[model samples]
Target: MRTLTFFNHKGGVGKTTLTVNVADALADQGLRVLMIDADPQCNLTAFYLDEKKLDALLGESDDADGGTLWSAIKPVVDGKGGIKPVDAYKIKNGLYLCPGDVLLADYEEELPAAWTGSFARKGRDYDVMCALSAAAREMGQRYEVDLVIYDIGPNVGPLNRAILLDSDFFCTPVAADLFSLRALSTVGRAVARWITDWKTVRGLASAESRDKLLHGLPTYLGYVTSAYKVSSGRISTRPHDYWESKIAPRVKNRVVDVLRAVDPTTVPFPSNKLAAIKDFHSLAPQAQEYGLAIGKLRTHVNSGYNAQILEAATEFSGLATIIRKRMGI
Candidate 1:
């Protein structure tokens, strides 16, 4: 199975929206999909299941027994050797969730232990870094899944470092604004550094040992721009001018160019026109309320929303198709 992480160092770029809804789109195509909420905030979980269900699913438990993602890697934090898979909810026939929790913050402090010389030389850092991916892999195989998508928090912390390295590839969600444009640069350079740094550490590991656990970092899988207004099914005039004149070029320079500079083998990202996406009016809230996808809201909600829902569905279906083709999945 292939793994993809929907991420951006900048928040509020509709990262979770794309991550969750894209999973829906793929599932609708009969692909077995698994979504892991790696963000401590647990926004994806809240979006799909709501607070009432979260309380029921991941009720109070000790660190050792928390049904959230923390359970899977708690052994690593306790200095154990490897990770085990955790329980996930089957949201539908083809989609599942390894839910998230606010208590996940409790484990973030555990990641810093990797900084020690002992952890690096022993390859324990790699194991801890790969805990989520390892679990996802095992779960994917068990369920015969086609894709695993991760919804990650916006940060440069060690937790994110691990998640990035584990995924097969990542696509960023940007808002077509200055902050997100700058974040595109930040994510690009930081990813390059982490990839090289982990490579060096892996090289130092004992040859022929089973404990050298570091896997190579994921490659860039282009990006998506969300919440932009569209006219005639194209980016609206005002936002298009600002984006075309400033943001798009900077992303080409910072994100695409930066990755290529670090590793010329890095795949060139798609154009801004392909990446820019529109927000469908009245879709998000309806999806959250009904546990539905933006693409499915037309059937679940009133017929009056038919046109708007079709626009959202077509957008994600096209986006998912491009992603699958580009990533060779």
Candidate 2:
């Protein structure tokens, strides 16, 4: 299965929201999609599951097989064993979720030591470093999924570094604002470092451990400009238009070109803008409350939201199509 991650160093850019809706849209197109909620905030998990269900899944338990991503990698983090098999929870016909845990944040503490040990070719550190990727791959194989999408926290920390390395492609979800534009440089620099570090790790690692590593860095899929204002079927307001106009050039200069400098042939896509997602307005909160995608909101709501619902469906459907073509799915 091909792996994709929606990431940005800056939060509140609708990263998790894009992940959920895009995965839902892909599933609607009949692809079996597996979503790995690697974010410690657990927003993606909460978007799909209610409080009671989350309690059942994340509550204190002595059982080693707790069915969350944290549980799957806990053994390796504790230096106990390899990843334990954990079943992914089915959200719909073709969509599944590997639930996120607040405790997943604990893995961050071990990463520094793991990274240091990796230089010495310590087998156990390699196991710890590869834990998340290994679990993702095992779950993907078990489910026979067509695609695996990761929902990661907004940061350039060790956890996110490992998660991004495991991905095949990554898309940044950004807002039409200066913060998002500035974050592009942070993301670019971090990814460039991670790619360089991984290459060194692979060269130092034993053949067995090297074989388990991802062969290359995650390619830059593109950026998604989300939550922009729309009026009379066009981007409205001067501030919105001005910032939106600034996004493409900033992305190319700050992100795409930076990656290309690291490895001139890394980016294969022609465009820097993937999709511009209009603000869903009230539809977003309602969909969140009902644990449904905006396009699927119509099934749970009345007739008042028909127009917005159709618009949301069309937007996500078109976004999904672009993603498939870009990924060659």
Using lDDT as the measure, the top candidate is: 2
C-alpha root-mean-square deviation, candidate 2: 2.9
- Per model, state how many residue pairs clash: 0, 0
Candidate 2 local lDDT, 58-102, one digit each (tens): 884225758789999998898888889898889898999998988
- RMSD of every candidate to native, in Å, equals 3.6, 2.9
What is the Cα-based TM-score of model 2? 0.95
Give the least accurate 10-residue stretch of model 2, judged by summed lDDT.
Answer: 227-236
Residue-wise lDDT of candidate 1 within 86-169, one digit each (tens)? 677898989998888675676677666763442357556655655666777777787888898988899878778777877778
* Span of ten consecutive residues with least summed lDDT in model 1: 208-217
lDDT of each: 0.74, 0.86
Q: What TM-score would every model get versus the actual structure?
A: 0.89, 0.95
